[model samples]
Target: MHDATVIGNRLRTLRKWRGLTLVELAGMAGMSKTHLSDIERGLKALDRRSYVASLSTALRVSEADLVGGPHLTQDPVQAGPHSTVPQMRIALQTNTLTEPATDRAREVGILTAEVKQLEDVFARCDYVTLGSRLPGIIDELHFHAARPQNEAAQRDSLTALVEACMYATFRMKDLGYGDLAHQAATRAEEAARLLGDPVALGKAAYCRIQTMPREAGWDRKLTAARRAADTLQPHVRSAEGTAVLGMLILTSALAAAVAYRLDDARDGLAEARDLANYIDDDPCRNWSAFSITNVGAWGVALAVESGESGGAVLEKARIVDESLLLGRPSRRATFLADVGRGLAREQKTAKGALGWMLRAEGVAPQRIRNSPQVREAVAVMIQRSKVAASGRELRGLAARMGIPH
Candidate 1:
């Protein structure tokens, strides 16, 4: 494993590069000087999204710059996903809506099927397979979308292109290519606008919201989500529309939670719950996976983001049907990881937190290993571990994360 890098070390380096004192940087970031000192000295974990956003904005760098990402590694299993990113970047950069970089493409029907298969791989959090397959599919879909044989073929190709770009947006963002993610999201939005389906447009809006700049204010994200949901309101008579709207509401809830607006966050969650009650099936499967089960998972995440205690988050988790989450491995892994993060906040429950994180890793090793939150949680547990057996387990996990133990 490569030597681990911590946010504190990066923060200190960036601060010095900018020639700013602790007091100056803290004032710029809207944090106390003492707090900034603690974060720089590695006495505190830079885990909160808001803090990361503020500091990145203050430092004039990306969130990934502070967090140290696109974590390249020697382990083949882990390195496979990162290797494909260069080709993915080239594909996105070279292709345009009017002209595809590649001339060869499969039939529209075959391309659609391939896109659907990739979607399933994405749900399973199989990043290696997804990354390897995405560039070709994206190029092919763009080709078909640009010059279709007929009107029906054009619509089908455009829809498939929208979905493919959505997947690309998510993959790029997860891999720490924020600019590529934004570019993909823009392509999705363009395709959706051409398709002119409200649900497709809603999905595109969600992708755009997800890829918003890390320094973007939480209020801006909340407003964008709410506005998108409202625009989709008249079309929610269908299950797909309802599910998409529900996802937008949940996004709003998360933004509000991060902004520390408890009442607004609860309102958004309540609205999403009502929408979830209307859909009996996973109508947004290829998109948001919006369902009652998904809603419950979002509730647990909301509780954690709102700074709830471990017991409170666990209480929320009890209502979620983990069995239902089996169909969506990424969601399952994220829910379990959120539970782990919540538990890790308290010293008394920190040891138990490792169990949930390990379960999440079992579900999605690539996702868990790449996650900044998971890395921070492991570091925290290592600091708090007192028992020899638990310490050994924590060290093993840290080693897997390439963190010094």
Candidate 2:
């Protein structure tokens, strides 16, 4: 077994290297900041089964590697030093990083190279092509979390990964791989506890709970989503964290709205709107689309689901239609779902609902092979679609996908 002091110190070092404050990292890890402080300081020992496994997922270290080794503190950038491979071997006792890749693993390896290259540009720079890569970027995060150089790198990657997971999960619904997406989101939440940033924690927690409703854990989904909502504060303390709050608002509120909790959904949207305003006024940054586009889309979605206001839905539709024209499959799926929800709210003939819902159904298969978010949202509407009280062929289409009523 690895020495407890060494493990703790390695964890602490990784956390620090990622630039996460103790409170942030602890919060991301789901441990109290004080307790994390004790562990890092050597006053307490890690509980291997529960704490260590989660820590491993969050840290990307193996059970064996976590116990003994020189431990990789190297940056997770794919270009890890070739020369250090030997030193990495000497210290690690068991060299996990140098392991060769399998066929599937090799694909993921290339994906990681591309993702890191893009993410570096995402973090330190800007480019017109960035939006084009968002989908692949999220996919890579799922793959990378399983192979981080250390807990800190995992923590560092958690925020972006969660953003991708939540975005895909909500709008897509059927991400085809529900289990993988759920695990990815769960790991992101585990890492959020280490981030110690309450705002980040709130965001990660939101994604963690969202997979619950559709994955046979509705009870946990409802409970955890509510809990995560409770954790987001109404302050713009950290510009980035606050911007992320907008994402939390949009995703968590959408979950609440879908769960049929009108009160929670409404309250969550109100807070989210306020956060959006704050995020808008701050200096422009990469998350501008996050705060503006997604925030607006989510608010409209919550309103359509929980409110009877046709004007509100129409208004939101107008805005989303104007700003969202990239044909990004996830965004298209999200917008189409909201439009269907709006028509459903108006009691417009099922035709209106059918029109948009069909477009969404078509969009889902075309954009992604497995999207749970779109499936769930579409399924809900399919439940509501009365075939617009007409269209025989359309009803057939709707029936096949499981529309209710």
Candidate 3:
């Protein structure tokens, strides 16, 4: 699949056609200019999946273009679906970059409403609608942050920018656009630094962890998670503080599971449980709804990730009421996907596993489509469905999800 010389030549051709110098392209791609130049000159290989993805996103091309597909003569933004990159570009093109000095109150109120709208859109899993609106929201935040006002105004503007960038990171990662997500994470981190708010910084760190490429190594992810938890733990008495703490700890448990440190994973989850207990079931932080049940949901995912199976995983999942999970459809969907995984991996309850996977898709089709573990379960369940009547429904669900029959 790797043709290094061909890939390098395509990279050069695309860069020239787009009128981007190596430095500009490298900045957009989150790589060094020298490294980008080396790849274009065929002195280095473009063999890594992450690098190729970032290069394609930077050049406003597709992975297919970099990997020997036909050249894309149209605007790159026109190539993808309603993803964040295209939308952000549109936002930049349309919105005024300079903010007027006199309408500070009006602008702040507008931003507050927009932030709530964005958060509600995410909560409802209305991704397409959210994508459509994000460009304008992001553009407005940028304009607000670009101008200097009072400390309160600047902090509010920067926090809004951080939130918008974080949303972009989360949405892009959920859609499997790791490279694009990385750019958003960088913006979130930069904005968080500008705000100088500990909570925003911690949230930005969480976004960085969420957007991290899988090849970055699970151990590195675990380290980042621990650092975020440590940084945010000092403010654990407040609800938002506890929510951020819980988020970091939840991420740590998952990262530890992926790193194969089962004990560390459990310890992280235990801390998450404590933080969750501090919250009052409300969505404490913008998108992070930290609650005891949410911690239990993570426990379900961790158990599956750690290769726990059979009744062990099922019993653990049972401890958290399904109703508690229902408030956040995305989290509930993920939990059910893990249930499917645990069952399928153990090979003890094929029919039940298929049912759980189907239920997850019913709750959130995008979550299942984006989840590698859930897809694997579907693949295994497809094989099992070959013999049983219950398998017919699984087959139908797989077909609806575009799984090959």
Please provide, for model 1 over 286-399, each residue's C-alpha lDDT reduced to its tens digit, 9 standing for 90 to 100.
247888888888998988877675788889989988988788888899999999888887777777788999999889888888787888778766765777878877887788
Report clashes for each candidate as comma-separated counts.
0, 39, 0
User: Per-model C-alpha lDDT, please?
Assistant: 0.83, 0.49, 0.69
Q: Answer with 2 or 3, whichever has the higher lDDT.
A: 3
Segments of candidate 3 deviating more than 4 angstroms:
1-85, 89-106, 283-287
lDDT of 3 by residue, 252-369 (tens): 8888886678899999999888766655765424247678877888898888767677678789988977886666777778788888777765445766777788888888765565
Write model 2 residue lDDT over 92-189, tens digit each, in one string: 22211223222122243455455545543333212223334544455445444556667665554555555544443332223133343455455456
Instruction: Provide the TM-score for each candidate, comma-separated.
Output: 0.93, 0.49, 0.75
* Superposition error at 134 for model 1 (Å): 1.7
Best by lDDT: 1
173, model 2: CA deviation in Å?
A: 4.8
Give the clashing residue pairs of candidate 3, or none: none
